[model samples]
Target: MAWQGYPALREPGGRQWEASAVAWLDGGLWLHHSLCITEREGTVDVLTLIAPCTCGRGYVDITLDSEHILMDILGDLRPTHGRFPHCEEPLDCGSVHAAPRPTGWR
Candidate 1:
């Protein structure tokens, strides 16, 4: 069970490092507190966390985390403090774990 993310590689290294079984091959998540999220090829050195399952799409909504606006992500949740499942913890309906949500406020 291995997952991976990568920066854009160059020359011969590009397209040379990809997993065949979706076992952390590509599209790894990257998180930094600075502007301009620069990247490269090769999933060997990036991706914050690997997918913990084989069902595809890590954390249920990992891809949409940073892509969608918070409000959009939230949709209609009463505009109040709600509990989100934490990435490190399993999802609980009543417990309200805090999940690693995305931020596009740039």
Candidate 2:
């Protein structure tokens, strides 16, 4: 499913990453600073999301992490809310939640 307005994590070269790549763990989840691409009307846009920490109870911005691998304890928190901190306006989390999962997703 496409989490519209959901922020992505980026690489140093400016590649976009998606939040869906994140995985839940015992306490929190691993927010991957990876890539996510979207196309509309033949136009493609890239977005970046702020990294979230498990223990701090808030989101943290990540940069220069070429490995793009960071793990934190999120506890019960999840990005179900389509509108992330970086969004200029609130997004419809409903649509994002309703969208179908990406191919090969377990």
Best by TM-score: 2
Judged by lDDT, which candidate is best?
2
Total clashes, candidate 1? 10
Measured on C-alpha atoms, candidate 2 has an lDDT of: 0.36
Task: List candidate 1 stretches off by more than 4 Å.
Answer: 1-65, 84-106
- What does candidate 1's lDDT look like per residue over 1-106, in tens digits? 3623333323343433222222332333222221223466423322122222222224332323343543453453223222223344554222322333323212
- For every model shown, the clashing-pair count is 10, 11
Task: Judge candidate 2 at residue 63 and give its lDDT.
Answer: 34
Model 2 alpha-carbon miss at residue 49, Å: 9.4
Report model 2's TM-score to 2 decimal places.
0.23
